[model samples]
Target: MTTMPRYLLSVFGPAARTDYGPYPSKEDMLQAFADTGAFNDRLQREGYFVFADGLEPATTATTVDGQGESPVLTDGPYLETKEHIGGFWVIEAPDLDVALALAADGSKACRGVIEVRPFQTAESVAALLDS
Candidate 1:
């Protein structure tokens, strides 16, 4: 039997998509959330979904580095951009083709671009099993 390859599904949506605006009407904001929620529900139905999460706006983010006791903690994003990584998922599939398909599906669900990268180990399978 062959083991399936695992992949990282990095989902990037419109930076302000989650903002939903400070709508004048409460109903307007509610409707926007409904649409996003429905999309998330669909992803749950798909077997390709291994895990999923959303991120807070990059506005409040701070960069950090170095050791814990004296780690360098910087304000603002390390790299400024209109968009951030947003969220991601870890999925196991048969091959690159399948992974890409899943990524496309995720993009549709997230209403943005989804990049899929196959996870690889520097050592061969035999080497891992022997260790």
Candidate 2:
């Protein structure tokens, strides 16, 4: 049997950092977590779950760039955006349509925008690095 390809579902929401955006209330936060856990359980039962997690606020982020002996390290995210990725999930799906369906559930579960994209294969990553 052919295996399904993996896809990444990125969840974006208002930044939790008070310096950046309005943070959700404690009740809402707990509810979101509960909903997400149920969703994850469903995905697991369906054999679609790979890995998933919620992330800390962007203020805790450090950006490292520069392709040299000593890479450049900077504070904050690489992009200045209104919304930041609050969480992510790696899932196996048969096609983009299935991935999109899963992303819809993820959106509801996480109470955020869910962006789905396919994972690049090892060969593709090697080619990109070489180029």
Candidate 3:
């Protein structure tokens, strides 16, 4: 049997802001949230949804490094950047075209930029491990 391809739709925003960037007003932000919730429901009904959630501000993140003899804990995001992933949705789709279409709608719903990317297959990961 063939397995469906998986994609990650990441929502990007400023690192300092927890909300969905600058909105004209509080009502606009609330409308965005409502739209996003409806979009998520549609994804679930269409059987493309896997997992999705919003994340806390970058200030609340903790980074861990375990490559050395001892694990190193660091505060803040792994990368210091003006933008960061504020939320994400993991979805299953037949192809990239479909994923991109879905991401476009998601972008509008959340009032944020959506970055679409495919997950590496298990076979590809095994090949990398063996190399």
The lDDT for every candidate, in the order shown, is 0.67, 0.86, 0.91
Q: By TM-score, who's the top model here?
A: 3
Rank candidates by TM-score, best first.
3, 2, 1
lDDT of 2 by residue, 31-131 (tens): 87799899999999999999999887887799998798899999999888888998899999988999999999989987889889899988679999999
What candidate 3 gets wrong by more than 4 Å, as runs, is 18-24, 126-131
Candidate 3 lDDT by residue in tens digits, 1-131: 98799999999976654344545567888998999999999999999999999987877899999999999999988999988898999999999999999999999999889999999999879999999
Candidate 2: residue 54 Cα off by (Å): 0.9
Model 3 Cα shift for residue 113 (angstroms):
0.8
What's the lDDT of the predicted structure labeled candidate 3?
0.91
Give the TM-score of each candidate. Answer: 0.66, 0.84, 0.88
Flag regions of model 1 displaced more than 4 Å.
1-3, 16-18, 21-47, 67-69, 122-131
* TM-score-superior candidate, 1 or 2: 2
lDDT of 1 by residue, 51-127 (tens): 66766666668998976778898987788766677777787777789888767766655555778887776556667
Which run of 10 residues does model 1 get worst, by summed lDDT? 15-24
The clash numbers for all candidates, in the given order, read 0, 0, 0
